[model samples]
Target: MAAVPMDDPGRTPSSYWAATAAAGPDIPPFDGSERADIAVIGAGYTGLSAALYLAERGFSVLVLDANEPGWGASGRNNGQVVAALKHEPHEIEERFGKERGGELIRTIGEGPDLVFGLIERYGMPCDARRSGILTAAHSAASLADLQRRVDVWARRGAPLRLMSRSELESQSGTAFYPGGCIDPRGGAINPLGYARGLAAAVLQQGGHIRRQAHVRSIRRAASGWQVMLDSGSVMASRVIVGTNGYTDDLWPGLKRTFLPARTPQIVSRPLRDNLRKSILPVGQIMSDTRYLTVGVRMHADGRLHLGGGGGTAGADRPALYEQLPREARRLFPQLGDIEWEFRWSGFMAMTPDRYPRLFELAPDIAASLGYSGRGICTATIMGRELARWAAGEAAIDELVLPASSFRTLPYYALRGPIVEGTVLFHSLRGRLKTPG
Candidate 1:
């Protein structure tokens, strides 16, 4: 791991997420004292989702963001609306106990349901297609791992099927996979469009959303929680912090439990319709089974988004991302003629348990962050649940990830180097490599 600037050059949105997505209507920052039933400290999916549910419940809600809504990971993700758990359910049951852990498993598997349902109900223009996700195994041992996952999910009544090499190659664009697993409930979408659409829906529901209101500090007030922005202040009965990897200086030690990582993506120039169809005829999105997975999706517009590997400001970013074009050429050699267009990156938070944390920082100030890389769907679902909880309408059982508490990472000051080193070694060794 190498040290780099906390901020980077042009770490904002780019790639296809920007091209097809519209910027959210700008909302002014908080300028004066304010009161609300709930104040959400982010305008990403988590905050927006919380606000949407809060508004529907007829609670007064205000959302504040440092930048435009969806400018964070919410808008700039791989857009793979996948629903399968990153870990197995039985393992979840083992860790958190059967009752609570099963609930968590069910919540995550239902994450995509919330996303697609919102898309249909709101008529969001995010290219919300309901196809399955395929995760491949590159080696025979990896195939055994897939078999274990298949058995585990099947025993838990999940709809998963393991595929042979032929089936894997058919679903994927190339013969890069020996085998894989498919989730019928999985899908993909235009993430930026989805975020913008959610903001619009939140506004239509009479919720208040403000941008450029970077929260400086959050403390408990005599009545509830006091959120102080750089320019203004707000008091709310409940506070929801959706800052995730950007959790930053607002809260000490919390961010250390989760590793902040940057994943890069590339979008090729649009292709011939025939070429696109040949690659993803069924319009499915795919990723590998490696610890750091590479997720790819063929768009309706004859383009593909290539994503995998992890790094950030502190570590030497991996060179694997540059291998995308060659990988794509292997997948569809005919794609050699298509010119490459945009390449960009976004940061995400990861927990060692590979599940998100939803806990209270104070009596009334709750936070929902640290989704690892499953942000596209999980963050939205967590946001909704967080809203319900804040409204006093939902219980801890509503949480998707087990809320069983653990000690915070021991060394807050040293976590970045520690986590980055661990990830860097495995990332380079390809020991964590997924089947493509």
Candidate 2:
């Protein structure tokens, strides 16, 4: 069966990233049968990064996407290059065991190094910044959690510092947060620009990317695998699925493994110079410790971008985004009246354990998704891990996240209503905890 399209599969969504990032490389759609050592589905950060690494290792790689590169969450994200996962270091270590969990924590903590290294190595002009990221606390309980996180990461020799309420107010120009913690390893980037730059690098490395080449299915062949597309097919020894939150039924039960939550973002018109300096004066990206976290960052062009939980509503509804502007005003009261220029929403997969999974769907076929909200750095690193597995440099068992079977979420069909209710509960809880 053909997969359901996510949004307009032919056109890129109108976003601040799309409006500012450079155009993607010109590539034609798949039109006939082809052979490659590796066939990858989805042309976002994960697929492109995998193909680039594979091509660099002298492997014949072909990537197929229903839309242009960076058309999905990779491009539409808030663009924060966060260096940690949804779970704290100790939590991960406790869940996965000391040895394996420690490896996971180390890998996640160093994720930003891989991201910035690639940007610098490829000369990607994504308005990349390493100013750091702040996890602000919305309440005293949240502040205690932030303190715990700081202590945990600090013990691991991470460059983290806890900020007092006064310090947070001075740095963020908002007295809303009681406290927070900053991680110097984290930063920001024009996510679409990074995605497009990765595509160009893949092309330069001799990898082929076909746009608007929606895959219909993947079937086991006499040898390797066959990727069936609307216009053509690809036969390869290995296949990687990197579709993330936009995943469909192309693979049985894959989409059911995680819940896709919509996150809506609003970008303001370039703030006046005084207002710009007053907010995020040091250029750090920030997300609070609310149950439904709110992200705040300044775009390269001086526009203020804010996003939070969007429930189950479609992106086209203007009402879905009204809360963002109000939240922005609450955070930065200095902006009495501000003009929002762009509003859009995208999905980020959520796992039961809130950790991204690497699944061995079948022999020689692997899929990775469910980054929660920390996709920018995690996805980039996941690509390199996938490439390693394909190149025989690392076995599935040796990969940082050892390959595991898919565990579909229970009551997956009711995810929409469940997520909506959860969002409502969190919204109310957050408002009560928020100081006036």
Query: Which parts of model 1 have CA positions greater than 4 angstroms off?
Result: 1-12, 315-320, 330-334, 395-400, 404-406, 431-436
Candidate 1, residue 304: the lDDT equals: 75
Candidate 1 lDDT by residue in tens digits, 1-436: 4232225442446568888876655577667778899999888889999999999888899998877788777877789887755776677788888887777777788888899999899889888888898887867787888898888778878898999999877767678778888988889888988988899889888899987777878887788888888887999988898988767666656666676777678888878876777786777888876676778888777777787655553633546366667657765676765677887767777777677888767667778788888887788888888977888976755665545353577655576676667667766665434344
Residue clash pairs of candidate 2: none
In the predicted model 1, the residue pairs found to clash are 138-435, 290-434
Using TM-score as the measure, which candidate wins? 2
Window of ten residues with lowest summed lDDT in model 2:
1-10
Candidate 2 all-Cα RMSD:
2.0
Error in Å for residue 172 of model 1: 1.7
Per-candidate TM vs. native?
A: 0.91, 0.97
For candidate 2, write residues 250-342 as lDDT tens digits.
Answer: 898998888887778899999999999999998899998886888899876789999875545234457778788899889999999989999
